[model samples]
Target: MQDIRCGSCSRKLGEGEFISLTIKCPRCKTMNTLRVTRSEPVCPSASPIGVSIEQTHHPVDRRQTSYG
Candidate 1:
C-alpha cells in the first residue's frame, strides 16, 4: 500500500495501489497527478517449486494527432 499526499500542503490525501491517478487536494485545492509501476512478489505457495511469475509494465503515450 502507498500513501498519496498533497503536493502543496503535504496533507494525506489517500492510500492505495494505483497505476495512474489524478486528484485534487482538499486543503490547498491543488491538482495532483501520479504515475507508478509496482512489482510485487508472487506467493511461493501458489506457484510450483521451479516455476516463476513475471510482471511487465508498458509506457503510456499521450500524443494528439492532427488531421489537415
Candidate 2:
C-alpha cells in the first residue's frame, strides 16, 4: 500500500491503489488530484478476493408497546 499526502500541507490523506481520484484535505482544506498508472502488475492472482460481512443484532425495547 502507498500513502497519499496533501500537496499543500503534506498531511496523510489516504492509502490505497487508485487510477484517478480527487480528494479534499480535512486539515488544510486543499483539493488534491491524483492520476496513476502502474508500470508493472502488483498481484498475480487470477481471481479477485471476496469480502465477508458480519451482521450485528440490536437489543429491543420491551417497555414500549406498538399501537398498530
Candidate 3:
C-alpha cells in the first residue's frame, strides 16, 4: 500500500487517511498542507517551475557514391 508522510515531522500516515486540504501533524503539531499528484507526491511549501524541451532528428543517405 502507498504511504503518506507528514511533511513537518516525517510521521507516517495511512494512504487516504488525510480527508481535508490541510492536516496537523499529530506528532509535531505542525500545520501541513497536502499536495498529491499522479506522478509524485509534492512538498507543500514547494512551488512549480516552468520547463521547455526541444528535439530534432537527422536522416542519413543510404545511396552508394561513385569515386574517381
Consecutive 10-residue window with the lowest summed lDDT within model 3: 51-60
lDDT for 5 (candidate 2): 80
Please report the TM-score between candidate 2 and the true structure.
0.53
Each model's total of backbone clashes? 0, 0, 0
Per-model TM against the reference: 0.52, 0.53, 0.39
Mind giving the per-residue lDDT tens digits that candidate 1 earns over 1-68? 86887766778989887767778776766777777543444774463334222223223344679999
Clashes of 3: 0
| lDDT: the better of candidates 2 and 3 | 2
Ten residues in sequence with the least summed lDDT for candidate 1: 51-60
RMSD in order of candidates:
9.6, 15.1, 21.9
How well is each residue in 1-68 modelled by candidate 2, as lDDT tens digits? 77888777788988996767778777766777777543443477544354222222222333766797
Ranking by TM-score: 2, 1, 3
Computed on alpha carbons, the lDDT of every model, listed in order, comes to: 0.63, 0.63, 0.50
